[model samples]
Target: MENEIAIHNEIDLQSKIYTIRGMKVMLDFDLAEIYGYSVKAFNQQVKNNIEKFDEDFRFQLSSYEVLELSRSKILTSIQVKGVKGGRAYLPYAFTEQGIYMLMTVLKGDLATRQSKILIRLFKGMKDFIIEREHLISYDEVAKLAIQTSQNTKDIAVIDQKVSALATIIEDFTSPEMKKDFLFLNGRSVEADIAYQEIYSQAKETIFVIDNYIGLKTLVLLKSVPENVKITIFSDNLKKGLHQKEFDDFLKEYPNVTVSLKRTNGIFHDRYIQLFGISEQFTALIVSNSVQLEILLNL
Candidate 1:
């Protein structure tokens, strides 16, 4: 009977875990209940030990995210703690590391038991994934080649599904030149496309920090979302970019707004900061500056 009860608890815990920002996480409400505390009191304990929970560990949900999660049935519709009419403060989501950190602050039998179960659950998942990745290899590639030669009916759909699954596995395990994009000589067009793709991910703002900027940078800014604001910081060395260039850029892409500010020799290297609606990503700079053909895959 104890074993059956344990199985039921595991199922219940599994339902509370959800994937957000490509990481498995649990919402504050669910975690609070698991740890035997009210959501209000739970958050208070976190606040008391706020230093432990960094951005990777825990992050608050944006209003848009709340609606999105609710629509997908990942989260239930709920109002802010004290607000009456509209949603004010969205709940915080804790990553695996953050959930582990919560136990240190929350005491008692419930916290201890839940922490042990969570450790076991995460360990099992890691082992399962690590073991399965070995299977998406020689057999799958041979099958793909065979299917292509035979002119299969669902070739397009099948290929897409296979590629998507491979990409997910690669994102976690393979160091396919991880996080570093090495552009070669005569690949200016490809470099520009890569930069545009990274810029397009920003929902709110994109801050480009380069000590030596030029007219060429304005061309890259054109791909950013019309609603997102852009700020470029460059030193005096950026004399290559004339006021006329920016004027021409704005005239052509009036919807894309970009602001330029001089750093006056403060920054040493180039960096791109992509700020999402609810989260902020910082310091994604190619090593040894950008003109040297180094950029982020992120």
Candidate 2:
């Protein structure tokens, strides 16, 4: 019973990251499903074991949040069981620690397995986010494009550099690479088709250094094979509010690591090291400042 609940929670955790109202915490629903009791029964367990859930461990949604969730259709459609208030049917949420405590309160073989899987899932998410934060800051990219536009001796030189960069990006999407990857041109619409072709041949890993990563980017990263890794080199400038969530996620993945270093005096060199080993790699560098490389099969 506990194992079933934990598995259900794992699936739930993947979607309800931001903790809007309406999403049921795993243990609540899982226990209810197993014990033939209401979510209130699960809540009673938590109430009985308050020590298990600290401020860092758990929290409830605000009335305003609950209302917003109701408006947005983000809350669960499941009817409330033991809840006595108007919000009983609304979804509730829990943190990693909260879930852990809930398991201790429940006390069963299933509870133990559920707790382990939950911790692992949370850790994995943390690792992913931390790795993502290491990507290039948006300001750095803008500064570089501006710097090149201002300093280049002739428009042709700037054009040539952009062309070369475009070509290199295009080659990444070749047909030969398609079997291994499903690349999408993130930086430019024009690069989309070509980038797809190059990515098909990719193996072992995929690296991307871009300014921004939203939901679409996250989905793509998750699509890669487990054996393959991805690394990004970029500047860490902004303290976006959502940044913390991602930072927490990167703590989960052991294979992925992030490093923040200088690129050029002005613009950070946003590059990737894909399918590379430590000693043997290939990279392109235009200026003495922005050096890019791939270490093949390290």
Candidate 3:
């Protein structure tokens, strides 16, 4: 039974290797967590060093791709916020070589330790693969038995494989950890969701901006508590651009201050930053001419 258990464990691990289809992928944010860098900073590094990473090792997520991920229910706690426009480049997924390159680039005490541990773990997996291949001939009889018996032994073997696969997955991916960061994608809607999260945590200091504001946005902005200090800066536009009713609603919130900076170029990119108790959360929104294109595209 002990030897059977050991062989089952090895088989389960091997099955996953095949199941993965030889494509090693790690989310950019997850890799960032390992390297002790914020996801934003980590992505910036990748953007800066595009030559080091090929399409096989790294690729940005498209808006549609991100939307697909949102449907998976994996993003329960974190909302995917958009960049300046409604579209967002998805988080890059890295291959094995990319992970190795990342460790080299992000070298430090913690990174060194994580790299060493990961390398050793991968080595162990490789060894397990080699050992399993050598034992393939011995398993032929067991395999034949499994095929011949549609009985209890076969069911037990199947169950063992399934459970072992589960264990290997748990070990390999390092699940069951708290998520440190999340992403939000879309236009101003993304900003609204991300800030609401900060508000849920009872944040006080918040900064917001939107060159094109309307009744819907004004309603969203009104949700902020009066005690909270909010400074909103936006591009100066012709009076009555949004509508008289929308502008009139602004008078109701004295604590929430809005400033319009005059600029010929039109302050198009919208962003909101919230300095909570300890951490900072920002959501980028696109307004002005870009917003028109987004609506047209939609």
Candidate 4:
């Protein structure tokens, strides 16, 4: 039974390995599944021992990187979910060394045996690639075949980018104009445009109210003029954005300020209030739904 389980695990590990950023990596979701743990639990362990995992050992995937992997045929077999449910944060990827280091952190007999099997599987894959490289060097036809395979992969990447570009163009060229009330279904191109427009229009004061705000929200405020005074009102100062990360964001935009005030169970909605140079106030009430509704005072 132990032998059978090891064989199954080897096959499963092989399937989960992916090439991202010129390195082979296994996503946190798949790694958690192999270790017999929930995604949240697995990530929590990593967070607890963050000092063990360096930039080379593990790295979080960006939104664009995640989108690219989603569109790839090679990665289609992997279950990559969007920022829904309990997966609001981005996924992390672990390299071969990182996987080995993870075993040291994970406890129990099952983790020990599984770690040995995974290390063997990783070594086998490396040997196989090395052998293939040697074979390709001796045979011209083999080299050509490898080159053609890479070209096909490159074409697929290009096709995916073109499709994304077409979608953005369609959103921009659409005849529908901005309305006082807008319903945004997730993070669409139109929603991004609206966010930018709101930030750009803030001439004097820009006030934001949200329970949780991350690096993505900070990026939207980058377009605010230097003279504009930006203020953030939140229950927690470092809920989504860490202290160090928030400090860096402040360095980039020195005009911004943050204030924390606990509602004691009253505030629950997200809002953005902009004050123009002429003291004209405009407010945007954002609904906390999968399809976010933006009530704008134009």
Candidate 5:
């Protein structure tokens, strides 16, 4: 009877797993309930053992993310109550590692049993995803090769799928090169790092497309090799002081050749395309507010 109950609990737990911030995670409230603790107490214990959980293991959902999750129905009950009501706190989300680390801090027999079950479930889910990817990769690559020999339209579709699969494979194999989607509200550290990475890899040219270009955006390009060619396609050529700032930057970096063009057509989005030797290129599609960045290798 006890074994059956545990099996049932594990099955229920699987349904609670959610993909947030491109990671599989569980909300603090749900985990607390499964571990037989009140939400307040469970979160308190996590706070006390904060060192056990790093940014990758646990993260508090942002307001934008909270709204997004609620709209998607992944977080069915998410809402903001009055500030005085103590229900206004943003929820903490725990990844697989965070869930496992909880076992070290949480006490009681129920916690122990649930932790063991959860660890197994998390591992099983990871294994399943990896196995499925491997199976799909073999089938997809064969189809893609055959499609390439056929026509341009079919080749384009195959190329897109192959690029996506490559990203997935890189994320699984080369964890260090795994792409990160970063929020770009302010001076984003991740954005700076990404810029540095792209600049470091560039051997020939850097192409940029943004409707509006400002000094802040140009700051990210300063570290590019002095010999590399830079091209900017923008809707607005007159950015007042920012244009002057870019002029000064060009004067300072004499070896860098930058050409700014007023885009002939309406282009609403931003992209940073880096071209390297032998036709190798990588691209970053950035949001207008600099609020989002998606990195892709081609």
Candidate 6:
């Protein structure tokens, strides 16, 4: 029976786990399978009791994460629902604690038996990591990522190969973006990814020019590394971003220093500049006149 349980752990349990947002998690589809429910039904149940799941317990993957996970066989499987013909919503992922909360909400003999097995498995995994914590450090993980992907483009492969530790490094740190040119039109998510990736590279300061800047702009700037000074010039703060909204954002992300100023009709365009180490710089031109025809010039 011990041998049988070990086999079950390796196949039914560990194989379903994936590293996401610095935590090991199971996708909604996989959890639905184990709990004997349709993906739609399972998600609906969780939504009904959403108060039980916090950001750490459950969270939706970002658009870029969806793109990255699509490379995985489990995600690419045709059986996965809510991901076809321009997906209505991204899938939700559940952490170990989330699974614990979920078992309380779900009923049935299968759920009861499976929850016991899962708790045992979760305990084992936690104990193993605790015992080996001294063997792992943030610096060591960073060095591993640097060594494995000297060519940063292969960084996605790290997500596939060394998912657990790779996810920790990727989450705590940003990846190198090698795009020399990115054109954006009718693509909100891709544009957001580009904005975040470029901003994450800034070591000291950022310059921005957008006539219609708003709270959403600050949301994008949330990706800028801590302590990076940001200066923005906008023609329509009254109509777009208000002082209150700006203050709230600053309070929430106190580490991100930002200043907003009016363009005063000096410029009629949108662009961004990133200043990094040794005074190196990069530029992005996003035209509001064309409804965001963006160009990031590296």
Measured against the true structure, the TM-scores of the candidates, in listed sequence, are 0.42, 0.36, 0.33, 0.42, 0.42, 0.42
* Model 5: lDDT of residue 140: 84
59-117, model 3: which lDDT tens digit per residue?
A: 66555655665565643322354744332446666766777777666656666666675
Best candidate, lDDT: 1
**Predictions in order: lDDT:** 0.74, 0.51, 0.55, 0.73, 0.72, 0.73
lDDT tens digits by residue: candidate 1, 97-203: 99889879888766778888888887888898899887777768999898887777578779989998676445434454443443433232245667776678789
> Considering TM-score, which of the candidate structures 2 and 6 is the better prediction for this target?
6
| Residue runs of model 2 more than 4 Å from their true location after superposition | 1-9, 20-37, 73-92, 136-298
RMSD values for the candidates in order, in angstroms, are: 27.7, 32.1, 33.3, 30.0, 28.2, 29.1
> lDDT by residue for model 6 over 1-298, one digit each (tens)?
0011222343577777788888989888777777778778888889899999998899988877877788777656423225556446777889999999999888877777778878888888899989988896888999988887776757766657788655533432343422222444323334577677668878988988888888988998987888799999888745888879989998998878899887789886567777766545545464421233344545
Rank the models by lDDT, top first. Answer: 1, 6, 4, 5, 3, 2
The alpha-carbon deviation from the true structure for residue 202 of candidate 3, after best TM-score superposition, in angstroms, is 99
Model 5 Cα lDDT, one tens digit per residue, 40-88 = 8889889999999999889998877777777775457654433354465
* Candidate 1 collision pairs: none
Which sections of candidate 4 miss by over 4 Å?
1-7, 77-86, 137-298
| Alpha-carbon shift of residue 55 in model 4 (angstroms) | 0.3
Model 2: per-residue Cα lDDT over 22-114, one tens digit each: 333543454455433456777777778777688666665555665554465554543343445443454446766666666567766655665
